[model samples]
Target: MKIGLYFGTFNPVHIGHLILANHMAEHSDLDQIWMVVTPHNPHKNKSTLLDDFHRLHMVHLATEDFAKIKPSDIEFKLAQPNYTVNTLVHLEEKYAHHTFSLLMGEDNLKSLHKWKNYDVILQNHDIYVYPRLEAKGPNREAISSEQENVALKNHPKIHLIDAPVVEISSTFIRNNIKEGKNIRPLVPAKVWEYLDHNLFYKK
Candidate 1:
């Protein structure tokens, strides 16, 4: 099986995530899209993240109806401060028959060189990148070619996909929920129901 790993915190899976994953599965050569729920990311502040189980369940709810997409808790058993390269290696060892590729936004591509063993990752797996609209904010830092590893952009293993630009983010939904605003439309029906019933992110 040709699987595409779409890794994220998914504090609360939103419609944007589902749309992108569906697009990748339908439009790309991948046979399946595994939404890998990270238990702990080295680059993120873990304090703000929801419980790993809760986030994974939300992803399950969001992708239940999608035939080609499914939630993955593979990272939960891995060591803390999980790195992509480590996970890829583990997956390869466990599922030798299944080929794995990476699905990421263009913005993440800019910083791919900074990831642990990025060279090894590039050499072993293909990368499918989707477009991301520039975030407009005072805190946003502009990325220049000078700051990026230009070789990565032109790597033979890199594939630039024409997926839709989804601006919705988990942080946005979480903030809205904290403000007592309805984020029903931003997430799947089942996910919204779960969040509402549990009063998640309302604190």
Candidate 2:
């Protein structure tokens, strides 16, 4: 089986996540999409993050109806400050029968060189890159940032997929939910119910 690992904190899975994962599952040659829930993203602030299991359960609710996209807590048991290279090695050893690839946005591709043992990651797995629109905000200018990584972008193993540019983000959803706004349309019905019942991100 060819599994595409879509790693994220998922902080709370939303429509944007589902859309992209579904697109990859249907459009790409990948046999399955593993929405790996990272316990700790080195780049993110841990204080704002919800409990690992809370975030994981929300992913479960969000993807329960999608057969091809499943939630994975593979990183929770690993050492903190999770790194992509290590997870790939672990999965390779455990699921040697399954071939694994990475599912990432073009922006992440630009910064790929900075990841730990990024060379090893590229050598062993193919990367499926999707289009992502940078949100224009204060002191931020929106441009075609995807075109910045010329060298990596042209790699033989890197595939630039024509997936839709989903602009929605977990930060956007969390801010609205805290303000008592209806985010029903932004998340799966079951996921919305789960978040609401638990009063998540409402503080």
Candidate 3:
């Protein structure tokens, strides 16, 4: 089976995430897209991150309606500072039958060479990149400044995809939560209900 690995902290899985996953699943040869919730990203600051288990649960809630999307707790079972290279290796060993591809935004794809053992990942697995605003769209200004991932030394394994645009961002949702603003529209209705009932992200 062709599985697309969609990695994120998923602080709270929202509509935008679902939209991207759905688009990938529909367009690609992926049998399923596993939303692997990383416990800790080596390059990202962990101070603002929610508990991994909590974030994973939120992903579960948000993905319950979609059959092709699944929330995975793979990183929780691994060592700290979960790196994509290590995770991919472990997944290949554990699930021998499944073929995997990495699904990510064009921004990340452009920065691929900077990641650990990027060469191995580039050669071993397919990388599916969805276009970013800077590449084609007029929405140059984002909710937060993501480094313009303009420099791309393309590898043979890379595959670019044009997933439907959904501007809703996870950072914007978190900022709204911090500012005591409503997150109803930012997340799916079920995820909104889960956040409300569980008192998640209260200031």
RMSD of each: 2.9, 3.3, 4.2
Best by lDDT: 1
Clash count (model 2, backbone only): 0
- The 10-residue segment with the lowest total lDDT in model 2: 135-144
Candidate 3: give the clashing pairs. Answer: none
- The lDDT per prediction is 0.87, 0.85, 0.80
List the candidates ranked by TM-score, beginning with the highest. 1, 2, 3
Candidate 1 per-residue lDDT, tens place, 124-176, comes to 99999887787223222454352244576578998989898888999999999
lDDT of 2 by residue, 1-203 (tens): 99999999887888999999999999999999999998865567776688889989989988888899999998887887768899999999999999999998866677788889988888889999887765223212222343344357568889988888777889999999999999999888988888999899999
Which residue runs does candidate 1 get wrong by more than 4 Å?
41-45, 135-149
Ranking by lDDT: 1, 2, 3
On a 0 to 1 TM-score scale, where does candidate 1 land against the true structure?
0.91
Count clashing residue pairs per candidate.
Answer: 0, 0, 0
Model 2, C-alpha of 88: deviation from truth (Å): 0.3
Which parts of model 2 are misplaced by more than 4 Å?
41-45, 135-150
